[model samples]
Target: MPDYQIRTLDDADIAAADALFLGTLHLPPTAAEQLDNLRPSYVPGRALGAFDGDELVGTAMSYPSALAVPGGAVPRMGAVSRIGVRADHTRRGILTALQRRQLSSLVEQGDVIATLRASEATIYGRFGYGVAERVRSITVNPSTAEIRPDLPRVGRTRLIDAAEAETLLPALYEQIGLRRPGMMTRPAGLWGIWRVRETKLDGLARTAVHTNADGVADGFVTYRAVKSGGFRAELRVEDLHGATPTAIRELWRFLIGLDLTAVIKAGSQPLDDPLEWSLVDRRAVGVDGVTDSTWLRLLDVSAALAARSYGDAEPVVIELVDDLLPANTGRYRVGADGARRTEATADLVMGVAALGALYLGDVAPSTLAENGLITWSGEPGQAALGRADRLFRTPTPPYCGTFF
Candidate 1:
């Protein structure tokens, strides 16, 4: 018999769930502050608990959100977060059961996809989640970094207080539409936690805004400084948003120009951020880290495939092997126009996990084929794979700025 049962979390279960999640991470709750900051964001019916009779052994939840895809398509997605299972319950089927319940619920609610930031690299692939986005950690030496002369700037910058930042940043994020794939809408509750509850400033991180000649805000950056050594400090950026390329350039220039700060470091930067290219010495900016950021699982494969626009290429039929969602186990023809179910023989075959990775256009077909993740059917299969690559190519790599 299964040792635990999975069900929707209730109000009474909140404390236990929070305790389990925080305890597993070894963080104690604040004495003066409760999880009141998280209460407002608690999505009713979206959280699930796995219980060993009266005891809660595991927890997981998802916030309803939309994920921006290539060609300006935004699909309804469930942002999976706040997941934890008690250490003692390790290797039990509890986690698998909870995941199955949540993912199934997401599909029933018509969610096209589910995305999560995996705590470990090894856990999610078995559940059909594939690495769909990447983030880079960058360190820039401000003294040696100079903006290239040819890079034009149209905006001036000014500092702002945290109060002003909380009021203005979200609006600017909305104004800067999700032009790139992998970006998602930051819901209001998350904004509250990010600006007020989290960060070193304790809700008062130093903020700066970029403004055009007319004095309209186009970009903003939130960062804090820490003394690293004698006469030197590190400016750690919390978040940076730009409405345009000029805005991005201006904000970056301002951050690197801060006095007393010898180095500026930021995590979760888009892999394609042009900060290095715009600098006089590209070597001044070092990629200190790189890692997979978002893992995506397609719940409704047909709708997921049709939601995003593709590149100009001939339609290619590929057979999918989906054990979790058996309905997706079939052949589909995909092209620049869109994707559709097809009865024709598939030229290529792959598991759903591999398909999710290819969905973002970040993983090339050639790479997948070389890695043995893809199987070719005929002599013409190689050409079909080529066509698939063209259709999935994106001008920019996919990146999700939101952490959850």
Candidate 2:
């Protein structure tokens, strides 16, 4: 017997585990902040890892988070991130054991979904996790961001200190979280993660905030300029959060207006975000690639949907189909009339993975229907269902600043 088993982590395992992680991924050991945030001090071992005797081979961690089903409320979610296996232990059942235990444990704890950023695109798809969202990196020649000087400005903008983000970020995040599904809740100390990434760039990163008419810091943009080969500038955006469209637009405008930059590279954007459309030369920017940002497991999709506010009108009765988890395979009635809940109903239905795909608007009704993911009664029902179906992202795109 190879003698391999999966179990909860322990603080004593940190040093060895960190070493194992670095070796598995073939990257230089990260700074204290990256490791600390991923494996918190309190839970030094909150995650599960596979071991062979005293040797640590496979590890995975889950962060406390949430998922908002538009038209319903937010449900507590566990984000399974930083999953890795030792290079030497390529096969065997280490990964399977870890993931199986993690998913079951999360479901047992009442998590509506278990999300993660899949490193190996081929790995997680087999674990019943469908592609829920996509992110794209853009390399823009900043010297050419020719933002219209008089671009119809909406809200007052100010350059807020990164330290101030702690107090302001949560409010803005909550507002956006309601409409987006793949968002995660940032705990107190974890608030410093964004700042650390910025500071690591040696002052090249900058942030700009937007305040509403009532004087609220509703949004912020974090970006940095790094050296590029051939003397071209490479700017990467850490994060951008805005409560209202007006604020988001202005923050974007501010970013576009940055001076003396050669290239602006941004990632973690939503697929259909309108930021590219806002540019004078639409084709100037190109999507690097569309990779899944979040994977969802519908532990209780019904409860997830009934807890949030939805579209502007009436109600929708949907039969949700989950091929993996049989529990969520049923009918759910969601309405924006303030009454959101799942009921045993006799009606049409859609697959859980399809809903996950729709979670980011990556999948549309006509396409889902065409693919048999959902049945469209007629043109009217199709239109109503599409409108009633809320997607989780802004026009700028939803990007998790950190890989987690």
Candidate 3:
């Protein structure tokens, strides 16, 4: 066995981490820029490389993200992605040391949770992470699809040039990410997503804007058109947000009713999204299936609690202990604002990674307690813990738009 040491990556490691990431997947180091776009929260120091003497053999990267839940907003969820160990380093406890080191660092900083887009579903479970939501999809006929069967709504659909996307799209994603779950921040290069796929970026792709009483751009959808016997579309909703129903409906209708051939494909939707219901014919909607995109692992419980906004309610204290990710061992008193008010007088501790999943969405505390991942001090305390979680519940299960 070669000598090994785990250390926080610095500027020098960017080259090595990029090399390992690219080589394992057989891409050039240029992918570092692309993957960097996916990781808006990456700090070189926060990303780690497991080294064997002079060679970079493995890596584990995490970043800041958010989860959309019912009633209110939560902030700063840590999403773990791009975790890999070169084949040569496998089964040697390299992964174990890397995670242990990362968890220890996160615990010291006081962050409660973390998430990931798992490459192998089976691998992360042993670390105490679990799937919290399923990202579902829909395929539609574009020829038959139209924003409105007849004319336009209060909003308008325009074939804006790609250059305009830099200004228009990011504003729209802000609203969507704030109100929705399992959504992560978009990278700077996202503005180029259209052109890489098409030359004009407007042939099949376009933006539909919904404006409110004040005439502010509220929500938008981006899609590609395919004309067959009828038109077929694979629509990806970049972001949809607004203050009123008309604004939201207008954007939804614009995409679904676009002038096309027959079908449309849309994915990464929230479970309770109203788009399907807005259609007069419910049968027109079809669900491909629900699947998980974001898998969570808790880094630190206290910082995780205090990072985002929560709903209004009385405060509750709960103790937490961890197994698989041992660094996150502590008791926490969570507040109505979703803030951490105090360290628990004692540690309602569960596995660190399981807490990360629960933070990503709603994984009931009692079920885990029953499963023996946690020990509830009392039924009332357990009930309080469950109800306390109401703040992080999502209108839809968390869904990531792209694979990490």
Highest TM-score scorer: 1
Please state the error at residue 400 of candidate 1 in Å: 1.7
Indicate the TM-score of model 3. Answer: 0.73
lDDT values for all models: 0.83, 0.64, 0.60
Of candidates 3 and 1, the better by TM-score: 1
How do the candidates rank by TM-score, highest first? 1, 2, 3
Off by over 4 Å in 2: 31-45, 154-182, 189-203, 212-215, 229-232, 276-288, 305-355, 359-361, 365-403
TM-score per candidate, chains pooled: 0.94, 0.76, 0.73
- Put down candidate 3 lDDT per residue, 1-404, tens digits, no spaces: 34778888875566567567656665545444454443433465568888888788998876544544334445445556557789877899888888777766655544456667766788877776777666667764444444434433764545566567657777666754454555566544334432332442333565556665566677666656554443343455544455455677776666665543355666766566565555656556678887676676655555556665555556666665567544445666665666554554633655665566666555656566678766657766666766656654544555455444
Candidate 3: stretches off by over 4 Å: 8-16, 23-42, 64-74, 106-112, 142-152, 175-177, 180-214, 225-245, 306-319, 324-327, 333-349, 367-404
lDDT of 2 by residue, 1-404 (tens): 26887888887676566667657767655476565543452244347889888778988767677765543345787777657789878788788777778777777777877777777777875566767667777766655555454557776777767567556666666655544544567654355444434444543666677877787777777777676556555667778767665677778777766766676767877665667666677666777877777766556666655454544555667777665566777666655554334665524466766665555444555566777767757666676565544422223333344454
| Clash counts for the predictions, in order | 0, 8, 46
lDDT against true structure, model 3: 0.60
Give the winner by lDDT. Answer: 1
